[model samples]
Target chain A: MNSAETALFGLPWWQAFVGGICTIAIFSFLYKENPFYRFFEHLYIGIATGIGVMATINTFLWPTVLKPMVGADRIPFPDGTYAEPYNEFYLLYLIPIAFGSLYYFILSRKHNWLAQLVIGFTLGYGGGLAFKATFNEMLPQLEDSFRPLYVAQQGAQSGIDWLATLSNLVFLFTLLTALSYFFFTFRRSEGGPAEKSALAGRWMMMGCFGAFFGATIMARMALLVERLEFLINKWFPLFFA
Target chain B: MDSSARQKDSLAERLERIDRRVVYLLIALALSLPIIFGWKLPPAEMETADSFFRVVDELQPQQGKIVLIASDWGPGTQAENKPQTMIAMEHLMRKRIPFALISITPYAAPFLESMPRDIKEKLEAETPGETWNYGTDWINFGYRPGLIIMIQGLAKASDLHEVLKTDVSGTPLADLSIMDGVHTIRDISMLMEFTGLVSAFNYWVQFFQADGYRPPFVHGCTSITIPEAYIYYVSKQIVGLYEGVAGAAWYETLLTKKYPGRESGTALKINTSLAVAHVVIIALMILGNIGFLVRRGDS
Candidate 1:
């Protein structure tokens, strides 16, 4: 059967009816805040959280921890294939289980230090990783910032490579001025070069922020457009068509 | 109060105090009408998206070159990230490229599996006698915790099969036919990250690509994150970037161009709606500002 004939989630017409109601209920907030919108909002959050928990257990916990430890006799396949798995080394996982249980000691006044040990170790490991990550992440960007303001033509017939030089020059100027704007070492005189460059940097930063704001507006509009599309194209047609 | 004075006050004051509900209604109408009536607006192809298509277009199938998809998005960003994920999967499947998916965010695991599965099923239905078997075409590693560390492990591991022990279904990674020649990070031809969060792209770049492990990288991100990602693209850390819905629409156009008769999907419809909505917003902003300026002049 095609989409129109087939039932979504096995509920025939009720699926579309319920979905249309939910969409309208959510969109009802345009007029004013109401019980309808609030109800669906809460419903969405609750459903999302419940689904997240179940998925985490079924996908992450089962395969990574429980199934590996217990060694199920039959592997549950989506296609209904039964596979054998022998039970062995179930006890080894208990070590980490016991160690992780130490996290509960934070509830106690006296044994809170035990929990602190785990926290400290986790922080230290994270800090070490961050140290390495910072260098790897920032260095390439820093290196790439060094652009040549002039370029010689290799194969192209274009004369003087003016655009390439202008692009690099603008990048260099923006980088320097932006950095200077943040320099709080010693106050410069009122009309000094330092102050002028700093002012330029402020304008450039504002321009950058404007671009960011424009992009944000576009992204938000995309979300609105998508919801409207769902309501009009997908949900509305059930009754109207 | 005199009639003329009252008229001026009402005009400017009413403009300033126009109920937000009216604005919301206008926005809703602007977005809904175009979609309901089936209006089409072609999005301009972006340079970033063009570069992204070029990279994926270069890939040859079944050459032992795998693509790694780092999917880190969830329901909150389904509008943007879902289309991005779907189009990328469609491209990979169409090209017959072997790819593996892994999610760092726990919430994204189901999406990582389900979206690709849906696309695969749809493609199978459309093409006659074309087969995309689970084990042979693609595999999912599902969700792994330790976002940065997990990527680092994948990057440094000599054998990817040992690192990623099993697929989402609990089948051993070694059992999949797609995993035949895929043994290490070196086997990956390209890495594409479809993310709502910009930091996930940073982790991939910092841990995987920038550390002298040079697999060509591409990013598909929410429009909010696109500006920041431009730095990486300019720096050559990423070969290309796709910016939200418009980018996805452009990618779909390219796909249709390559393989004619492909259906213009949700991306195109949403892109047109977005164009209308943006115009409405800008007009409102202008009108609001004009009211503000007129009130200031009167005062």
Candidate 2:
């Protein structure tokens, strides 16, 4: 027997058995939908929700908000002054807490407006940030689009650098055509300049989608390979020998 | 009567109506057999991975400055993101650079705790006498639920120690020797986001800057997000990018080259399986296309 097999890293031996069962249940859908898959799916959602709720309370709420308001975070000095990172104004936290709690008003038929109040406020806040962030995020990209058509040789070089200049030309072509595609007013039947550009734009968009599809396939395959490895190396070994 | 009634099925008709279960079984075999047997392909060197390694290698551990890792991956992308995060974090640890892990997604909380500790244990064991104690080496800032608001707020705050007052545990950030020098957004040396979420990357690019002090940004994206991630890279928003498990394998390759005899990671092994799976899928696609053409001709 291998030394590694003798001990399971403090995890009970049943842990792997359960993990194996859950994995098989999920994969059972590949053959046909079954009750095992449905049961495990529900179990997964319940467990994930439970973990998320517990983590939020343990890590954020209890420590950040509740501890301060209730003075659980306070450590007293020898002389009785507060030694902890706390303030008397923590009681004001109830205002935001009360406001956030309005989210549960979504359950109330008549009082759903209370939930809308918080939602609207949050949307406005997000919209304002998005406006500022959009400019910050995009301006540099816009600036980058102004690629130099001509590459000057520097440091003892004499002629144009073909590779970099070729790349720039490709970028310029791609950008103009891709952006021209959004000219919604131009009709494809007209066969005008906009039509030609828009056609080119459509091709570029298709190319982008194809690339995305290809990468998605690779990513999904990686996941499948990993799970297979887990099943082979960890799970299957339990039955053998 | 039997001979007339039982006309032989054409290859096109048979191929066109392949049972999905059969295809699934083929895929299962293609993915599994390589791992069960000992088949592997060496990871290819990639320019993206090279650049990713370079930026990390160029970094000097400065007092009051630490690398901020946006560990934004969860269970869905653990296949790609886990290895990517491990390699990058391993690099940072090997360099003896102090780093902090922060996650905006609730799903990312378990990873923030487990991954770093795992790396610390591995690194410490492999290299004797190297201490990777928490707080001194790295800190976990746990899960922050508010995504963009939290980021922008952190950027605008004058004092990070005040805003981000505590570690994952309830322990005060001020008590951590690492946080002594780190006070503002400007104190960060670099930002490395490992995530599959496109919006997570966008938030950092858009808002993680103040006073024109934008730290050099890099990313490790799941394979699916690589195309979008490349746009950021080309735009110069992201200084370096390593794409998926293949990219992680490439980074590990760089490490193996730099420091010979370093115990290799499983990225290459997983990537080999991925490559084989790709070949099987592509071959099936070709066969399926041929079947469609033949059936169309028959019709």
Candidate 3:
């Protein structure tokens, strides 16, 4: 590959080197506190927050709010290719959302009714959807909870998938025991099997926690790797040694 | 530190050992070596991952309907969520189903916010020959605050046009023919949520289902917050679940199965890094346990 192409994709390159240096610099805080790492960290946060705000406004408000409200023809395109005339009534819907934003202003100054309007609409909308989703999704799920302990289908490709059955039993046991462990309505025997099973359930949950923790660590590590690649592969190739 | 003194102690006492600094150094070396040498490992599919793939496999072109992807994860989770989102979008694009992208997360707007309009621009920029247009193939409902509120609005079909109309760049939802007949969240075939929050799944289930919406739901969340999700999965709140990097790797595998050459190189790099990391952590946990046992024996 040409030097330009090498500079573009290779390690010991510009973006990759810069990104790696930044990553290492950020990680250095683990060993000792330093102002340089803190500065880069803060810059990262600020840039991310700024980009998020700009992107949201560009994507959501423009098309959903301004385009429909002002009519699509008003929003300009680079070559004037996307100017489509739109209906006018769409502008009326922005009133509630605008009123909703006014709730933040009320936090510093207390007029209960102003905040209520936003909360009422938000809750009403959220409540209505939550209600619908509960039955449509959860009711069927509740019914499925009564599944047979085991099922056998003819001509199954795998002869008795033990893990499937075992996993189901484990799932069922953990669910019940965990629920029992939190049974606060009535007092429990101090050292019975019920308590023992509950303890087992607690341990099971801990095991799951360990796995989850491991996966989380991997995810964070992956993020670090990506950043390092950006620095090493794209930013600075000279420091690869 | 003497052997005669150690022998008098219990097994746990003898096992209880080693300073954490030693672990820190060893872990640092383990993680750094793979990167320096470019050592990559192969990833094997797990059962949960395989089940997720089977669900995607079932959603082929013959289904004649597209899945709805609610990508509420942005740059903060770009490392984890971006790969899955890209793979999911590629799948939908290849299947010829006109999928829609929506976001409820405040942080995630940059990636999908101008996507609908940008998709049109991008298509024009890349492939001008083939016939394609916005609203016909894909629609992006721009980022909305009030996470639960927006989801509810979706559930009830209230102000479907209004909701779509309020997009950031002022692109009306009605401008697209693909959205012409759709009024509610239930109108879509399946709903896939890629989030870092469990509340996203919880709010979706409680509100959307209570409203008579019956689309099968799938979820992808950060690994740390996924065990609780697995419980929900056992209870059947979510049809399939993909947690963190492993889930992303599984999704990549499925994507490769369908579209062989679309961004496989990056996926491979990701899978390699993940495998190496997982191994590193498992070793750390083992070392941690061994140290604990040794210290206990000494006591």
Clashing pairs in 2: none
lDDT tens digits by residue: candidate 3, B150-268: 67667666546755553345556666677666665556777888877777767776655435455777777776677766766766667777777667676677666765544453444
Question: Each model's C-alpha lDDT?
Answer: 0.83, 0.86, 0.65
Instruction: Give per-residue CA lDDT, model 3, range A1-241, as digits (tens).
Output: 8987786666645545566667778877766789989998998889778866776676656655765677654656798655666666777877766797868766755676677778787788667766766675567566766655664444747455566667677767877887777767766688987788778878877887788876677667766666655554544545443
Write candidate 2's Cα lDDT for B62-112 as tens digits.
Answer: 888999999988887888998898888999988989999999878899899
User: Best candidate per TM-score, number?
Assistant: 2
Best by lDDT: 2
Model 1 docking category:
medium
Compose the digit string of candidate 1's lDDT tens values, residues B100-208. 8888877788787788788778888789799887877888888887678788888988888888888888788878889888877788889999888878888888888
lDDT of 1 by residue, A1-241 (tens): 7775765445847766787788789878877799989999999889888876777787666766786677662567787655754556765888877777788899999999888877887899889988988888788899999888786555867566887889889999999999989999999889999999999999989999999999898888777777777777667677667
Superposed by TM-score, candidate 1 places the C-alpha of residue B290 at a distance from the truth, in angstroms, of 2.0
- How large is the interface RMSD of candidate 2? 1.2
Candidate 2, residues A34-77, lDDT tens digits: the string is: 99999999999999899789877887788888988989888888
